[model samples]
Target: MILWSARWKSRIGASTIRGMTESSTQKDYLFKTIGVIGVGLLGGSIAAAARQRNLVETILGAGRNPSRMRAAQQSGLLDRGTTNIAETAAQSDLVIVCTPVNHIVQFIQTVAKNSRAGTIITDVGSTKQQICEQLKGTLPAEVTFVASHPLAGSEKSGYEFSDQNLFQDRPCVITPDESVPAEAVSRVRQFWEALGMHVLQTTPVKHDLILAETSHLPHVVASALAATLATENFRYTSTGFRDTTRIAGGDPTLWIEILLSNRDAIVTSLEKYTQSLQQFKEAILNNDEKQLRQLLEDGKKKHDTLNSAP
Candidate 1:
């Protein structure tokens, strides 16, 4: 979470004194204490990244899972891990909400009840528009809310599967509103960069639109394919089917929350996809060889374009 004050404009480039050492105070401006509200893959990875880079002096991990929190503490993923969410939120300068989308608002309300006035609040949710809207409706005027989406994750879950380098060279989207402090936004960007990510900026609306097509659609399609192919009588599938459906094996609990939370955007994307599929179906039914060839060519070109690096 990154919060900005009206006076931050003057403090943007100025150095701050921390512990008797002025030493290029730019690094200390962003965040010194980070609170991660989930100790699973996303939260553990964030804590690991902060530790690996010494990005944060302290990190507090919070989750309902006692065993997971203890594992995170023992594994050096967080300076402290606790089952109490309010306790973690109170101590953190910046709190990263990494819980399921369904739990986001509840967590925010809990944090508001316990956290100090100036603590920043941000999230790593795939959908931003809804989250941002919820924040505007619920959060206090002092607590700044920045919606972010990290475009990196493995199919694996849990603290044991977390890797320090999970964010390396990956895209992290930071969506800040006009009300958000410029300094706060910059600090959030800086923090992500420190974690070895390529940061990009966008509005919550724009982020939702773009991700609905490129990211959400893929997951929906992959899941649909996986569901369609599974039958009691069916047997003996090859590598192509296995590879294509691999992401469908993602945590159903997580995906259910995601799909439901971002229903509007996903619905719009699915409608467009249905139209495209209808075209392909019609071409196949009519035995339109040229149309089929052109579609394949277009698909190949699109895949190539996506595969090109930044």
Candidate 2:
């Protein structure tokens, strides 16, 4: 088992580690204080999960809305809530920027400015290439920024809908460039692992491309499908329709930002998706039962492979 060195032990503090005996099954309390910026669904869920798992001693929340933050604090989603991002960053061992994709880089810049040396910073933004590029050379050498996207959450929003198990058994992709310190990457990986996430490492560019196909494209398709349904069709909706369009009900503002941030990759995925749709239309137009069956079988096999994969 890996042990904390004297330097880390000193940094972690004796009080925080008090009564924490080293054991194989012991959960790692990786952060003494965790600062979560934007205490909305994803941010609130992270704070709640960390508290439930005892992964952090304290969770400081920073957001634009005071009333929302106050409600979150009262609901036990945060230990304290503030509008000052820098102040929260200053006190936190790790700062997680959970704001919208557009605001994440600015939040990280604020955090980097106020945070001391050796602080590890990360973001939960859906797109990474832009964020990683914007953050490059903006932070002090002593600070580390690791971009992460947790493949979790639901169509639900707000702190009220947040759950402690939001990220349980979920895949979290960590995008760490060569500029990031090796130790910082390990710490962030362990932190996510403590939250019960299966940490996957990849480059920021690759992550953006993959998420465009897997996440952004799906949301776009769902929204389009839902939009195509007439208002009168709601009464005739079945489980299949509702299931396919569930994500269409997500916050439009958030999805707009995500799509725009990764527009290039999303557009590429959309082109491919449209091509497939065109092929399907052609098969139907020609009354080609064999081609249609083959297409359906191929899709089913691909989905089955995904479902059966570890």
What is the lDDT for 127 in model 2?
96
TM-score of candidate 2 to 2 decimals: 0.90
Instruction: Report the number of clashing residue pairs per model.
Output: 3, 0
For candidate 1, which ten residues in a row score worst on lDDT? 1-10
lDDT for each residue of candidate 2 in 97-180, tens digit (9 for 90 to 100): 998889999989989999988899999999999999988887888788988999987898876677778898889999998978
Provide the TM-score for each candidate, comma-separated.
0.86, 0.90
State the displacement of the C-alpha of residue 138, model 1, in Å, after optimal TM-score superposition: 3.0
What is the C-alpha lDDT profile of model 1 across 1-310, one tens digit per residue? 0121222222222212333465544455467788998777888788777766657667799999887687666555666788999899899888988898778867877876678888888788888877777767677776777777888787888876667799999999999888889877877888889888999999888888888888888898988998887586357787888888778878889888888777788899999999889889989999999998888898889889878956
At residue 26, what lDDT does model 1 achieve?
45
